[model samples]
Target: MKGLKKKRKWIILGAAAAAVVLISIIGASMNGAEVESAVVDKGQVIKLIKESGTVEAENTVVIAAKNSGEIRKVLVEEGDRVTAGSKLMESEVTSAQMDIKSLQSDLAGLQAQYNQAKNLADKNKTLYEQGALSYEDYNASNTAAKQLSAQISSLSYTIKSYEESSGAAGVTAPINGTVTEVFIKAGETVTAGASLFEISDLSNIYVKVDLIAEDADLVQVGDPVKVYNEDAGFTDENCKVRKIHVKAQEKMSDLGINQKRVTIEIALSQSTALRLGSNLDIEISVDQRENAVRVSDKAVFELENKDYVYVVSDGKAVLREVELGLEGEDFIEVLSGLEEGDVIILSPEDEIQEGTKVKV
Candidate 1:
């Protein structure tokens, strides 16, 4: 009975070993299959070019004093709205008025002298014709009359000049606008031709953008543009290109790189939120594409400075390098190395390897 028990134990042990071998073979076969993964579908993408510039009134003027004098009163302050011919400031014209009055008095005196000289010359001429006066006396009297007339004409011109100067003491606005700067105070003295105020016609404002010469050709007059400013609270306002400068300006720092830039003036159709001299960030659409293949920026990887995407084929992870075209905010355009039905891995981890088994 002990020998029969020993034989049964041996049989049980052999059967257990065979079952273990079969299970090992099955596990190895399952591991050899390719891993399955999720992929992104390719579609159309749109590209945008960005630039920064400042907002300015299309019609702006700098108010300067035509004649130098002390500022006695300022009619307007910064941020004041004014109309055309509005008084900006008044200079102390007390001396100017005195000079004008003196000139006028001189002109009157010259006119009186001229009238007396003319009467005397006429009387002398009549007497000389009648042989009552000597020829030398009449000639002298005629010459004196002509000289006095010339003097009177000269005085008239002087008086007109003084009048113009006196008028300039009251500075006036050339256009209807808002006063952006007030450089002179009520009691300050300013020199002639010095800027005292800056006025901007906010009704017509524009954005000035500098573009590199290489890329300037892509833009043209009448092109649509969008402008925005974070601080001034401006966003995506419709605007059109008003002007484009053709001259190329040299780059400040680089010598070998000879580049010309264009200044594009874009007129804002809606400027309710825009302010004069407000810095703005602009985006211009040079070209647009519809229904293009695109992928999330996170899925795209860089290797050796080259772009790549991980694709799933036959349930196996395959890394494929691709060429990129236009880049957007959340997605990048795929120019090559992808298809419409191809599946790709999203947010791949470092530990994931090729041919590794994946549930998704």
Candidate 2:
């Protein structure tokens, strides 16, 4: 019994010495490595759908060439402001002008022929009444005069039509707005119905974004949007969702993924700084949490389909499972396993293990 008791005492001493050595090694390890870390803090976490969009006019009108002709001169350029009835461009002597001259010349020739026919008809009428000419001959002379008169009238009507069509050579603005696009240049021959210009009242414009089907469903009309464009000095929060398209369009993504996207329009209450067709970034808050404990997304990682984060505690890395909530562009909400003021490792490496010693 005495020997057994001595053996038990020695065993306890040996175990204690081993524990001391282990602790020393752990202490050395804790002081050896350095890591970057951040403290968990409370702030607003907004779930936003980020998208790039284009500035577009609410009411864009495409002006087309009124007549097929060579453009003589363009009076207005892009960005020029004009009022109704302002001449946007003028066409050189067009085919219609030539047609008008030809019709007038034909009418003059017909008028001279009618004058000769009428003179013969009157002479034939006098001879026929005096019983010196046949009835058939007199009737033929009268018919010739009437036919020439009809031809002259018809030619005059055609000349009037050609004259009216020639007025289209001078293209004018139908509305008061700024020219946003100019498709025609001087000396370019364009066919009728070809695009000439695009004009719009740019005082009010809207931003158009194509959101995926899932994100589109989360947004509603009247939801406020934030528009950002650093180069254009446009950072506006007064824009609101105006329209959401009912149908989705199939588009190919940059990664070659097929996606169904729906178009949405955001109306800007004041948009003087944004130019038409300029690209801008937009953010719409689909969900938000106020005063929520959040951490940088870089600090959180995934393992075995579970979310985890490395927490700094007692100069050691403590692997903790985190229940994530709302995720934003920069930060993510931590519903559990984290607290305010708790320091966490940022971008923990793959080799970082639980209970590993670390220095912040």
Candidate 3:
């Protein structure tokens, strides 16, 4: 019985010892706060201005009707590749043709009368000089000749104008490009200067972006840019800013917010796979650092216009003031007060403060 009692005592003591060990472990773990952390590192960080842009042809040309005419045939459709001066359509310019003929006939009659009047004027001038003609007769002959000459000149201009209108019967492509839009078809009566076709040189394409004034201020001509279309799986990193507008204009955003925007143009390469008028994305590298001590932006916070980060040291959260340099998308450049291997608490909570226990 004494032996069994001693065994029971030993078992109870063993259980008590195990319970005390577990309690000590629980207390130790609860002493420090649970937090996410990251280590500071040195790497390249690029400050990029991301914006949606539209693909445009650098050499886009709009073909318009030279004169009023009825479309008799449309030989080219949208997406047709055409060369300069290629016949695109034909029109029936019957009215213009008839008008040209009438003007020409009138011009011929006026020329005949002008010739006769000029000859008479020349003879009258000689006769007046010889005292055979009066001043009134000479002046009348000269006036008649002037009137006929003016009429002939006016009729010639009319004939030239009608002939130009008649020449509009054949509409042609003015440049070498792919037809992007066709506004008129057969049997359509179009007025002079009406838009007929829109052609774009696909090989010479560019990206156009209207950046907000704040973003535009950081951009300049010759800045490196990356053009991409995520949905289409197209990307071209060899693009550069080609132009910047001199003025900013007020524009409405997609969400109806008013913003002042400046236009920027990016030049793409000849091998670019962008389609005209398609929306693509562009990232401009405005600033960069080849080797910068960087930390995740989440670890950084602002206090009274000063930047700070919660650095972990000696198992405690240490609030350290840091001088920031360049701001990047995912990380920020740490200028001072942070080392390459220092550990920091990511997204430190409001309840966390200096000297607070932190468990990584």
Candidate 4:
């Protein structure tokens, strides 16, 4: 009985081994899906902020009319070079001058009335004190004097405003620059604060970028930059951050996402005659880390504030948690949970999961 039982146990063990081999063959045949992958490597990872901007003059002045008047003389045209205090245009101020004179005359009349009323008020007060006038009469005289004084003051203010304003005067150049725009022609009627001309010193031109707020905090003045215009086929190898605006502005991107952006100026070493608003691409190396355990960024994904990468091993994909450091354009620095020689799936597909069979 012992011999028979032992022989039966061996037979059962042999049958189980055959079943295991058959299952292995079936699984291997079923998992023939192809996937792309990359190897974890140790190298320098450069964090870069890429932005596109336009070439803009360093200092631009928009000259607007100070008052509403008919343009009498346009002294400068587009492309005309001008200096500080130079006249750019002249507006007819005869009507404004006339209005000032009329206001002054009205003020003079009010002043005379105020004097008469004040003198009458003084006489009434004296009479009331000596029991020569009634209380109602004295009060009325005082009120009249006050009203006249207010009227005179108001008219005086009107005259002063006219005198202080640059009504019908010549608009002068505010700085040494070339006139880049002309909006008014002689005999054109312009309103107060109408834009007349734009002056700019092209020699002070530089690349202006609106950096996304996420990257703006990492950027600083004097940061190195590589600027190029792919369309114009021009590149400035030596460029650095010149200025950063104090405030952030909200702009809508082509994808219809609202983004907070800050303006940064780049001082260019290249000379190009491209006009203002010329587009250019810039690559700013914001930071760098050497000898970091890094992998292709395509291999990483985020879930619930934690990062995950699909790691490949023995024709299977396993999800691994990783702590990330500096993330660059192509690679991400792995601070923990991964090491060199690890194979990771790139551009992980939606169906990939833990223990999923993969053919890399």
Candidate 5:
């Protein structure tokens, strides 16, 4: 109570100063207690988490060779628009063709043996039924026929598979997109799994941002985000929080503070008109309130770790404790102890006591 009284005493004195002629040269009245008051009003308040990150190509598709061989021809060049399954390049297929021919010959030989075994098995079955061949011999002949058939079928599939793969060495586009890069040239040797072309659709780009671990959990997929390039005056409202990475990485801030950051992926519109890998400022909208009662930060003074503002009522300053919600750079959310149209002293000068009278 004593501390509160002392704070009011200082504030009242400051109010008396507001009336004095610090600007007496301007012909201000020195007798009237001059003070400034603002009518509390309701406005929109939004909680935004801001971060900076770079735009990257999303859904980039890589075209690779199916076989390790020399590039016979490059059908499509870089920057070419291609559809799915469009041939990008042809690989050297001479060796693959020869391998398939050898398998085919082996398959033919196995088929002939299988036919002979089947004929023998049939004869043995008839002989055994007529009591001329033993049961054991009949079963052996049948088993031999079945084994030959199995070998022939297996070899035939192998030959068919080889034939199919002989054409696979020709690299094709896996998706419809613009080719951003081509890694193989005519007569250049490229191994399987080696990237021969890189294609990007550019229909949708993503801005990869990192947020602190705590903030990451607050934002979710499908939340709207704003991205802006100040120099270019470009902004995209269609950007949405597409993904929040589960892994958190440790990063050092400009202040050298260690922060656990989780990467967030947001999709931006194709209209940014900027190249991939460009950097931009982004703000993620976490929460919003419409027509929320707000007061200027200058008016809310802290006392005992609490916020208090003075409202003038009937020629007296009424001290009221306020519950604040969002602390903005210019104004704060007034959750309680204030209402619309109520007049509060703007940065209530120190030394203004409760019940003190001042002219607005």
Candidate 6:
């Protein structure tokens, strides 16, 4: 009986030793798995989309001559400030003067002939009434007098037209603005309707932006915009959309592919140091979300037309499909599937798979 009891105690000790070894092996395996799931955290990530465009004047004018003539004088130079009725240029006055003189001479000759015919017709009418001259002679004299009067009247009108045109021999600014361009030089001959200057009213300016049709819906007549000229500086000027073109402009080379682009005219709300015709890079905020959960753009992934992010949960990566909204520069608004305290991979490795162990 003593021998049997000692044997039973030895068997109990062996069983206890086996159980301790099993527990050690399981703990070692769990530790190895935990190490494999480690992940490295990168810096903050932001989501943004970028586009480019240019600036333009809201009111621009090309001053041209009304009649062909030699440029006698230029009253203004490029970059000169001018106002309405300010003379910008002048055409040769010699030709205008000669034209006026010739018309006057023609009028004088017609008037002398008309007077002589009137006297001749009056004398013939008196003679005919007293049977001293023939009816045919009186009629011929009357007709001659009337024809000469008509000729005099026509010449007078020609003279008046020349006078009016001569008054406008000098080109004048139509609006209060600055002369931005001077296309004519003194002694240069310009044709009728040739552009001689470009005047712009810079008090109110417009930034013209050509935007793709897909993005045009976000723009409206009153939406706010930001404009900047890198050549000028980093500070951006605030502006408001004044107009949105509905027609899609075609690309110059490819007629087949009609690029749906609309011109957005943005009015500057504040004065800017930028000059007229200066090319500007523009950014228009289509939407905004305040105090919303957001993440870096790279963190979000697209698959099968759905958006998602890999969130680190319990030392493992879990694919969290998210609804996105109000995307801006370097950041995207997380509409769903994320909380403020959630840890998401900045830039997930391509090899990262769903349910993979990760340490962040």
lDDT of 5 by residue, 63-151 (tens): 66666778888898877889987878766656777777777788888889989999999999999999999999999999999998898
Candidate 4 residue lDDT tens string, 293-317: 9999999999899999988878888
Q: List the residue pairs that clash in candidate 6.
A: 38-359, 39-359, 45-296, 46-330, 47-330, 47-331
Give one digit per residue, the lDDT tens place, for model 2 in 1-360.
999999999999999999999998777775745788999999998888899999988778998765677888899999999998898887887677776777778888889999999999999999999999999999999999999999888877777665555553367777888999999889999987899999998877889999999999999998878988888777888788999999999998878999999999998866475778999999987778899999999999998999999998888889899999999878999999999999999998765789887878
TM-score of each predicted structure versus truth: 0.63, 0.68, 0.74, 0.64, 0.58, 0.65
Residue pairs clashing in model 2 are none
lDDT of candidate 3 over 222-310, digit per residue (tens): 99999888799898898999999999999999999999999999988547666679998999999999789999999999999999999
lDDT of 3 at 328: 94
Cα lDDT for residue 37, candidate 5: 85
> How many clashing pairs in candidate 6?
6
Question: What do the candidate models score in CA lDDT, each in turn?
Answer: 0.77, 0.87, 0.89, 0.87, 0.82, 0.74
For model 6, what is the error of residue 204's alpha carbon versus the real structure, in angstroms, after optimal superposition? 2.7
- Clash pairs (backbone) in predicted model 4: none
Residue 284: error of model 1 in Å?
1.8
- 78 in model 1: Cα distance from truth in Å? 2.5
- Candidate 3 Cα RMSD after full superposition onto the native fold (Å): 7.5
lDDT of 2: 0.87
RMSD of 2: 11.8
Which of the two, 1 or 3, has more lDDT?
Answer: 3
Model 1, position 221: C-alpha lDDT score: 81
Compared with the true structure, model 4 gives a TM-score of 0.64
Which portions of model 2 show Cα errors greater than 4 Å? 1-32, 92-169, 251-259, 269-271
The best candidate by TM-score is: 3
Segments in model 6 whose C-alpha atoms lie over 4 Å from true places: 1-53, 93-97, 101-168, 251-258
